[model samples]
Target chain A: MGLRVLAVDDEADFIETLVKRFTYRRIPVTAAANGPEALARLDREDFDVVILDMRMPGMDGLTVLQEIKKRHPLVEVIILTGHASVEAGMQGMSLGAYDYVLKPVDFGELLEKANKAYERKKLNESRDHS
Target chain B: MIQDEFGRLRLKLIAITLAFSFVPLLSLGLGLYAKFYDTYTDKIYGNLRNLVDNKKVTIDMFLSERVAQLSNLALTESYQDLAGDAYLERIFGVLQLHSKSFLDLQVIDQNGLCVSYVGPYQLKGIDYSHEDWFRTVMAKGIHVSDVFMGFRKYPHFNIAISRREGEKTWVLRAAIDSDIFDTLVRTVQLGKSGDAFLLNAQHVLQTKPRFGHDMFDTVPFPDIPRFSGTRVDEITVNGQRSLYAMTWLNLKDWLLVIKDDPAEEFLPLYRARWLLILLLSGGALLIVGGAIFIANGTVRQLIQSDREKATLDASLTQSSKMAALGKLAAGVAHEVNNPLAIIMEKAGWMRDLLTEEDIKASPNFQEFEDAVTKIEFHVRRAKDVTHRLLGFARRMEPTQENLDVNLLLEQTRSFLENEANFRGITFVRNYQSDLPHIESDASQLQQVFLNILDNAIDAIDKNGTITITTHTVPESGEVDIAIADTGKGIPKETLEKIFDPFFTTKKVGEGTGLGLTISYSIIGKLGGRIKVQSDEGQGTTFHISLPIAV
Candidate 1:
């Protein structure tokens, strides 16, 4: 239970690579190749943080983030976007996302931001439980 | 020195006008002179012919009347009676009473001897046989002899009448003095330097000529006409140009020649020619001078307009090139940005992963790190270059609003005032007070001001000054900003390219060169214009104009 996370993106290889890097960093990671798949997986699991890509084929990251926030209010999301999509990425952050970073993702910085998001989510959960 | 376009135009105009106006007028003057002189000379010749005809009639009448008186005497007197001197003396007395033209009257018998003589010489019994006059009088009824020295040894002309009295012929001959004919012919009026003289068939002058020709001298002619009416010809006499009119007398083998100097005769024509020449020359001067003046004014205007158009064309070409380049740069920068960012992060990730203790201890780990570092460095450089390109080609819509242009300039100037102080440069701001506010984007105008101010500082390099001035037009609702610099100015070759993207005088990595390009496009979007003036080794000035209330 070091860090529970779900990574959503349209690129299969990028998700796979993130999964491998997160596993080596001693964090528990799950991946979905699209926004709908990530939402369906989020319904079945209890992840503390979600890494959302703003661009996807079936469902965009912002759409997926909104669904996640409604069903699992305690979960925190971090946005991944390209330089051109920075404005939309900021919009996502205002919609209760933890933060945003530009691609190609630096896994180390992504891990740091993901861990912070997990801690914030756990802190809110603990408060609710107490 | 050679003439310029305008100078050549003026010269050609004057030349053409003078040719068109002067040539025909001068020729008409000359033509009129020739025609008038010809008509005048013809009229003068006609008048002289009438005068000579009247004089010939008088001379012929005088000779015939004397011959008639002698003929009456021969008929009245008998041959036997006329042999005596007394009856002849009575007839001579009657002839003298009528006209004193006869010098002597003589009576010759059939033997060709003067039987009676009533004159100054005593020749009462002179032998007349084998004399030519006695034979000419014996054959013809009457004979008028040429002037000769008679028995009196005086030059005289004689008219002889031969009569038959029952086959016995007697001749009555009267000798006339020649002095009476000279006075009649000399009385004809001619012009100054005009001479009227008589000539025989041999071209001898019978009467005294007032010119250089002496009496009895042979005068030359191209071809002597025979009994023709008065005809005039131009001939040179004594090396002077003269008109000669000749007429033949019917009564004798004589010609009347009149010599008139045309120059003297047509003095009024000479006077008219000089007046015409003077007037033509004056008109030519006045017209040519006016044409040249008009041409100079028109050509000056044309040259001025041509120069302005050329300057405008050059600037237009430069602006179009800049606009085209800006569009291309924007597209390229946008398309390449995503890929460059990807490469940068990937390389940065690789560098981050090599931090394990055992891998760091490897001999080639430093080389691996160096390669990754170089990749990241180059990627960052590429990012900067693309960012500048994107900035130059920015097509983002500007937010327009009412902004104080003076305040905007002050805020931009403050940004560079510290840098100016550090570089020992003086910044002079000449802002107009109470300038009319403009409807424009504040951020964009600030950016343009900052861009121009920063460039001015960089141009000065060290120890220089820049002056900024602003003015607002009340009528046109426009604002003008002039930024002058006392720095090493841009060359004329580079001035046209200064507003284009990536054209800079700064060293590598010092400037992106998109400052002015972005400022230009931004001003364009705001419906404004920028112009630059530069002198090498002196300084540069940039003028910007904007609508105050757009």
Candidate 2:
């Protein structure tokens, strides 16, 4: 199967655009409006990589990353930002986010981060199962 | 504060003027006193000597005439006729008629018996034998005696001539009144307080003073040479200062003393001295006062201009620094504007492609649309920033005209008002209604306010405050506007260089460092000054002063 993924942000348009693009590229995708929707989606599915916006209305990207790490220890997260709080995105990676991408991004560059995050998640899952 | 400066100037003026003028003032006082005193003393001496010399000649003539008269009588009269009372009375009466100074006449035998007396006193046979007159005439052929109080009990001197008859000696005697001699000497005197008196060889007063004392009484005679001429000596008599003009009369063997109080004698001279001192003192006061007044006025102007120049130097430094900053900002903003425009157009093109039919029908069309939208949005945002940079780079020469600074400030305030309100910031305005209009470029002045007020909003947190005030400076006749903000202030290290180009406290991409730089050049071109005052935590105040007319 194509890499399983969840894209999280408060910009519904940005998430909608991301889900459509990922589906066309043969990557299976899901979307969430905020941190709660993101965590709920994580609880039901085994996503390989989680795409997250660093700034949101409530439960910022870093805090949501902590919750994701506790529940799904094997899943990889990639941070997206407008550079408003690049420091927060950096902190999120140490908390187990796979990598980060700047907003208004080059499409090719973002696709590469997602693919790298998926490999790490799969590799961690195999080790845990073995 | 002004008092201290004026006081120093006053003292220096006084000291310098006094130094140059006091010596002459003092010399004039001494010279005037000396000149007048010498003149008065010389005049008194001249009068004294003239009186003494004139009186001496008269007295000498009187003595010689008397001696010649006696010698003639002795030669012409026989002893028989001179001894006869009738003949002797006739001759003596004739002599008395010529001068009333003669007192008595007598004829005495050389045996010391009074043979005849022809006078008021009864001396028909009074003992001439024991008297000095008889003994003096017997020893010398003729003699004039010293004054004595004889049997008559009055002061008189005798003139006598002795005649020889075979073996008998006959003496003819005459008494002269001392009053006539006193009258001759007493006529010589100075104006009140000055008197000429005669002192004899024995230091006895021969002629009494016009006021008091007997003829024979002693007088205080200074120890001068016997035949001294008119000489003036300063002496103290009865604890009073006097000018003593003295001369010796050789004919009468007496001293002529003219004693007078110098103050009385030189009263006019003393009065002159007092007047001169008063006049000089008045002149000195006038000169010193004028010097002080001139010094105070001149020094005050110098000090005032000195302070003004210091302020001007500081303003010049600020202007040059701002000029440097403006040039830098213009260079930077110009370099960034073209690339920013290209990026904006490219992002818009990306958005257009996402709306194409083929792409719209595709499953991934929505993702492409979102991506392009984000790109275009950010690009537009960056363009707004580049436009501000372009504004800085395009700093133009001021097109000056009359402007209401208050209105310009209000329009700039409106631009940031919404953001301020959303952040819960308050606006405090104190507008002076009578503020005069200033000549300035309105658009440029408005841009300056936009730069400063925008900075205020970014610097402050929620619930902050900004105060705007405008007034006319009375002394300078200039318009002043003060804009203050409650915010975390600039640091001490950055406050001086705040107007310098490319100096900013904001993050790199968030701030282009050209806002204040452009504003500075605009104000400089309009002939105005911009200054800032701030403390680390107390926020900042920007003061702008503009010329009312130009």
Candidate 3:
């Protein structure tokens, strides 16, 4: 099946654009305004990949990443942030993020990172089934 | 203002040194000189008193002996015998045999008639009762007269004695030779201008002086106490300062005076005083000179340290400014990036839409695509600026990695090789073959090296050489890299601010001006130093020294 993606950010317009870009690519996608909404959506639906913004109004990306990893170890996350802090990037990676990307990144690069994250999730799922 | 401060400090130091050194020196010198003067004056006066006392005794004895001889003659001889000229002559000869002081002898009756005379003159029958000695002897029994011109027309003084026999008086008189008496009084050994003489009660000279006046001439003497013993006084005669000692003779109203110039007598003391003055002045000059030298040296050190402190303060201010600006730039870039991301995403979405059939079919499709392309291009440029701002703000501890400085420099220079080649700039690498590795972040060091290389290439502009040299400083445990360029060098006025953030010589949009600022900060983080030296017309050289990994 094609990749099912969940994008979470406080910026509504940025989320909307990400959703449109995923839709135009013929991939199924979902959007959340913040960490709580994104976590609630993850509980209701199975997503292959999650694109998370590190800075948010409530429940920042690292906390959300930890909760998601504990609840659903099979799913993979891609951290996206406007603040280019290497320390935060390293923290996110050690917290089981698949990759960290700075904002204003090309859509093609983001799509590729999401596809790779989805592939890793599928591989993890298959291993669990076996 | 700082120069004035230092000058004042130096002057104060010199003043304190002089006061501390000279006050004691001058007071001691003056006190010693005064003591020496008093002691010397007392000693000179003491010597003069002793000399005058000795001479007075000799003169008194000589006069008494002459009177006793005359008195013996009047008492022992008969009047008939003394009146015989031949017998008186025989008595004079016997007196002369014992002493040469007597000049002549004569016999006179109580009426002042000269009955007998012997030697040096013919006054055998002169009128009687007219001579002062004859009249004085008749009443007093014995008389001594002062020096006078007698019938012989010569200066002489007589001693007379009278004897009464059966209501008749016979007088015996002897004339004392003035030359022999004068010689006895004037014999003294004093330095160069010393004189000795006898002065009678009337201030008349009884004898000739060594320097001035004749016998019986009036003389000026300083007022002194009329005591029997010797007294010393200082007097100025003929504008010459002299020390004179006087004593009254026991035989007569004569004053024995001995005088000498004190200038000659106190020559050694005066010389010592001059030597003391010379030493004081010489020592004062030495102290002043030494004080000035020491003050100058101390002030120079103070000035140098102050200058160093000022330079350090300025650099600290510049560093803090750079840090604050970096934070602001990072904050601004973070805030601006969100909007930049939205714009970029929207433009990408539009470009994606332009690929659809309906949008592609529109007549304005190319313009829409061109506009979207421009939006994406500018957005990318904005993203780049934001990324650099974040990098500048990221003052994280550098990761330590063993790095060969020469290899790192070569790699950095390679990035600008194409550009430098395009501008006809030549790269000359002088790498030490055995340069040691340093402990620093490789990528950060590369960034600093790249920045310097880029600046060097830019400075060279076109058709010039950029020389890169690397050497190890074994003593400092550091490695030095020198990048020199043969381009038009940085102007002196602009060189000082070259490392300041946003300070650039390039035109707008060509340079962000953060290259040197970032390089400086990076090198500092890596525990290295960066310095630049430039001559406006000659060229520029940037020297970077990095600590070698232990």
Which of the numbered candidates is closest to the native, going by highest lDDT? 3
TM-score of 2: 0.50
True contacts kept of each: 0.14, 0.00, 0.75
Predicted candidate 2 versus true structure: per-residue lDDT over B172-202, tens digit per residue = 7788776666778667656687665667677
What TM-scores do the predictions have?
Answer: 0.60, 0.50, 0.70
Best by TM-score: 3
Over the stretch B1-550, how does candidate 1's per-residue lDDT look in tens digits?
1136567777888788778877887788778877987887677777766777777677767777877788888898787777778987887888888888788889888898889999888888888879887898899878876555656676567889999989788899988986676677667777777777777778766666777776667777555759566677788754677887777765566776777778877788788878877887887778878788877888778766764464455446545765787778867775576566456656655665788788899999999999998987787678777767755554232557788888888888888889899999987889999888889988678878888888888888898989989998667678999989888899989998787655678998998666777777778878999999999889999999999866
DockQ for every prediction shown: 0.17, 0.02, 0.75
TM-score leaderboard ranking = 3, 1, 2
Candidate 3, residues A25-81, lDDT tens digits: the string is: 999999999999988999999998999999898798999999999998888999998
- Local distance difference test scores for all models: 0.78, 0.74, 0.85
Error of model 3, residue B455, in angstroms = 13
What is the full ranking by lDDT, best candidate first?
Answer: 3, 1, 2
Name the weakest run of 10 consecutive residues (lDDT summed) in model 2 chain B. B389-398
Whole-structure CA lDDT of model 3: 0.85
Error of 1 at B224 (Å): 2.3
Model 3, B62-123: lDDT tens digits are 88888888877777888899788888888889999988878898888878888999988887
Residue B177 CA error for candidate 1 (Å)?
Answer: 3.6
